[model samples]
Target: MKIAVMGAGAVGCYYGAMLARAGHSVTLVGRPQLVTAVQAHRLILEAAGRTEAVPVDATTDPSGVAGADAVLFCVKANDTLTAGRVIASHLGSSVPVLSLQNGVDSAEHLQAVLGRPVVPAAVYVAVDMPAPAHVRHHGRGELVIGPGPSSADIAEVFSRAGIPTEVSENVKGVLWAKLIVNCAYNALSAVAQLPYGQMMKTDSVPETMRDIVAECLAVAERSNVMVPGEVMSTVLGLAASMPDQLSSTAQDLAQGKESEIDHLNGYIVRAAARLGIAAPVNRALLVMVRLVEAKAQSARR
Candidate 1:
């Protein structure tokens, strides 16, 4: 099967490389820097302390999505609408698009813009790009995608590429569960520039995280999404599971790029407001990250 990866950052490159390695034709659409790197040396995938350059088609143009049987829409949450329009302009109405992003609402947002079906995918992975077109896998890489017309076929293809994938009818809950975890840690880590272990050492930090989690859960309940797992336990266990790892928001701020706080905590605040529910803790965290992101953007200017 031919696959197209939009916004070919770490997540896109990692999965695209896997599919390419499995003998599927893969094309990565992204910025000029990543396109140049991939064109010159393929995609460098580093996992389990081993590195291999996996060859695949690379382009800076959105039109690279053409002829793809499926698309992994991995753009940042803020870019969903714009990227969706771009894809819709280039592709036919039949190709399946999957939002393999950080937020709960991207698939809905993209579907609205494209006027086409989109599958929401809950991704459990900790991978980062150490350099352009290079993916460094840090932890789990499993996906639970929402049911759609082509979801089963896509899941089968992804599984064949060594990516553990399943189609879940309850993917919204899974997405919320992941979002809650992000809400609990992402902004705090970004603001302090600390890893999970060190962040937990700060006075009252764990309690504050619990408060944030509770707010997010309340917001989730208002939205009627059954957040899976023991939410508090999962939030607290993150430090032990990935002690040295910084949140993606932290990494984005460190790199002078905009973080996805608006989609994490900010999304909670919006949902709470819409549902006539209050989420003060989530609101505060959202504001804090927004301030930091604004400061970073100003520094760049």
Candidate 2:
């Protein structure tokens, strides 16, 4: 398979490396630093006290996606439209595009921008870029892609690369489930600069998480998304499962980079307004995170 990964950050590099290791022709389109590092030393994937240098094609230009049979749109939520437009111009209209992003609406947004079908994927992985072209995997690496004509073949390709992949008919529900989890923790963790375990230890934190989860659930129901499984347990279990792990939003804030609060809690707030429901807790968290982001930007100046 010829695969191209756009915005080759943490998640993109991890999966791209795996596929490259599996003998696929994988191209990673990313920043100059990453492209230079990859061309010099290949992609360094570190996990479980082991490391491997996975060789793959890498470039800083979106044109690198030209010959790809499939594209993994792995950019952050805010970059979806811009990256989609860039890649759309270079890639063939028939190429399958999978959106492996944080938010529930990324695929739809990409589709609107590209005027093509985009498969939504629920990514169950914890990864980070410690340095240019170096990807660290913290936990699970599985994907649930939305049903489509090419979904089964895409899932097979991923499975061969050691990533557990499934073609799911209920991808919308899967996305909503992940969204609820993000709504519960991303902003709180970012604001407090704490890991899930430490933040949940504080009194009233669990109750506050419950409030946020309830609001997200109401919004999901209003949107007709099922949100399968017990969402509250899933939200709480993340703290225990990855006690030392920091939310991606927290890492973004600490690095003075933009956080994805707008797509997480802000999404809920907007959905609530459309449904005539109040989401005060989610709204407050979103506003607080935005204020922190603004302050961080000002401090950098």
Please give the CA lDDT of all the candidate structures: 0.90, 0.92
Report how far off residue 191 is in candidate 1 (Å).
Answer: 0.9
TM, every model: 0.96, 0.97
- How far is 294's C-alpha from truth in model 1 (Å)? 2.4
Candidate 1: which pairs clash? none
Model number with the top lDDT: 2
Which stretches of candidate 1 lie above 4 Å from their native place?
Answer: none
The digit string of per-residue lDDT tens for model 2 on 1-301 reads 8999999988999999899989999999999999899989999999888999999989989999998999999999999989988888898868999999999999999999999899999998888788899999888899999988899998888898899999989999999999999899989999999988899999999999999999898888888888899999998899898777788899899889998899999999998999999999999999999999999888989
Candidate 1 structure, TM-score to reference = 0.96
**lDDT by residue (tens digit), candidate 1, 138-192:** 8778899999889999999899888999998899999999999999988999899
Clashes of 2: 0
